[model samples]
Target: MQKLYSQGSRLDVSMPVIMGIVNTTPDSFSDGGDFFSTKHACDHADKLINAGAGIIDIGGESTRPGAALVTEEQELARVIPVIEYVSRHHDVWISIDTSKPAVMAAAIAAGAHMINDVRALTEPGALAMAAQLQVPVCLMHMQGQPQNMQANPEYENIIHDILTFFKARIAACIAAGISFDNLVLDPGFGFGKTLTHNYQILAQLAQFAVLDRPLLIGLSRKSMIGQLLNRDVEERLIGSVSAALIACQHGANIIRVHDVAETMDMLKVWQMTQTQMIKQN
Candidate 1:
């Protein structure tokens, strides 16, 4: 069992936990315009929690391929109100998905429990800000910026390179006064990889467990699933849930997803089957 300690909350990751996505941006690949407003975002978050989500991941800016960046003020205005509303109403963990230091600080102050940075805290002042916040931080690996990440990503060895990247980021986090236990690692599927690269990372995800930190897998409604199954964004719920189950089987600690209810149902079934198998063995 793996445990992640945030400000004063402890998350048990012995079984895969669902972190439901609530994109406050209008440009996220899936469900972008659905929750752009504070009331709608907060309402959607409540629905996710009712559907069995342990964490609500709120993102103000879209990191989708070729996505344009938004101003810090715009990003803050988009997410802070939603975060404040959800945190005030619910007892669940709220994760702010941003790489900007100011947004991270303001979100934490507004009641976000974790920082899910796609830049892996490498953005200016981000590492120090995360350390100062003293909350759990998820560091993701992206080969390049979102605007051109998928243009032509190259790597001598995908898994090796990602592992190396995580190791260095872990070292940086520690040096910045963040505890290793307060860290989570994400392989950034579809962030900068081809279909082959994304599948390879999924197949060898267990290799990341060597880092001795919790793993956060976010493949929900991503292009990797759509491209593989020949499905559209709204039609990829089955593929998204299937991919999430695969990640759980491969030792992922947290599955960040869009379809919370469906994913939670699958995880429950998988957990029951695994328990029965263990009993028989």
Candidate 2:
């Protein structure tokens, strides 16, 4: 079995795993204010754990396009209590999603097991802080800041550019004393990509396996599904689950999603069939 170790938490990744989303922001594109309170967030984490999520990803700021940035203090306030609660109550791994150095430090200090930075640790002091924390860090590629990323995104060659970006970020992480084993890669599906770009990434997700790091995909309930199917947020469950399964088939090791129970059920059936196919072959 493939194992990912972070701050004493070891995860089995031989098959794709689910990382449930717990957004504590009021403006997140999906389920924004649903878990904005500490009590509510803790309850949601409990539900996700019961649903078989291997990791609980808690985010304070909303990274949706045109979203406003939150203060470091506000971000800390939103996620720390939940992290403390989950850490004390659940045995599951906890991922702190933030690009701020201080927030990263505080969250880890408060008992988060890993870091998931959308800015790829490019923010000031972020890379260094991550290196010092010595936890699994997910480096995601984004074209620009959330506020203006979707304004007019473009690329010379989408796959080539994203691969190059990952290479550089990987090199930077290694140079900063973070071992290669402690790194994960995210393609940032809806952060800055258009509908075509998103689909192209999904279709070619297997190409990212060449990086040798586990790929973490987060396309659940994103605009790609919404725009393609003309479904609202509450109606994109099927599309999100389908996209997640496609990503897993394409070599994704971790799928970050909002609907944990449905995703868990889908993976169970998919894994059973895959096991039977291998046995027959």
Candidate 3:
């Protein structure tokens, strides 16, 4: 259960790791267009590291609701250069937020350390490629594609259904050659969940512990925070960090966020409290 993601050469996650979000696309829900340029993307990544992000999650595609798809060439064009640039320069762990096997392969060839596939390697040949590449893969549970997943999102039983999906995927990965140690799971908040379902999963997040894999929660400045606080993406930092703290307190091993410094600061305070409780105990 102890494995490092390629993003930071992070061989450990017994404590939480702050994964900084770097969207090279022009349309991500948060921090889009801010680092569309390669230099800007690398600069922002360095900033995140200085702010306490252990991993730099770079994505070229926009998975936000109703966002049109970018062609593979466009996607590759957007992400590969950034990946190559950072791989050569930074000592940080580099994760390519891609679903295409071709892109994943190319990114790996270019020196990407982890494959954070939103599709959970469900894309054709993606699982096999990841298995062959033998990198840590984070399986995300998305109810439907980004196109219309939110249209009528319904879960027979949110937690059970997500666990079932993860179980099957984990089996397939093992069958293909990925080890449990190299696997992580994310419930794909806001990817398809209703606001109610989102909180329900968070409330029951610890249930995933039974699977015995590292848990990754990405509630950073998402719609869940926005809808909960009636705030926009630009103003959801407090709610976002609060949700991250709750997830970490429960059982999350990793938090993917847009605000790395703030999350780390909050985690420091949280660590102090936990230490006090332990001493008192």
The TM-score obtained by model 1 is: 0.98
Per-candidate clashes come to: 0, 0, 4
TM-score of 3: 0.96
lDDT of each: 0.93, 0.94, 0.88
TM-score of each: 0.98, 0.99, 0.96
Query: What is the Cα-based TM-score of model 2?
Result: 0.99
lDDT of 3 by residue, 183-212 (tens): 989999998999999999999999999999
Off by over 4 Å in 1: none
Model 1 Cα displacement at 167 (Å)? 0.6
Report the Cα lDDT for residue 45, model 2: 97
Q: Write the per-residue lDDT of candidate 1 for residues 1-281, one digit (tens) a residue.
A: 78887768888987889999999989888887899988899999999999999999999999999899999999999999999998899989999999999999999999999999999999899999988989999999999999999998999999999999999999999999999989999999998999999999999999998998999999999989999999999999999998888899999999998889999999999999999999999
Query: Tens digits of per-residue lDDT for model 2 on 173-233?
Result: 9999988998999999987788999999999999998998898999999999999999999
Segments in model 2 whose C-alpha atoms lie over 4 Å from true places: none
Native-structure RMSD, model 2 = 0.8
Give the Å shift of residue 90 in candidate 1: 0.9
Candidate 1 overall lDDT versus native: 0.93
Ranking of all candidate structures by their lDDT, best first: 2, 1, 3
Model 3: lowest-lDDT 10 consecutive positions: 1-10
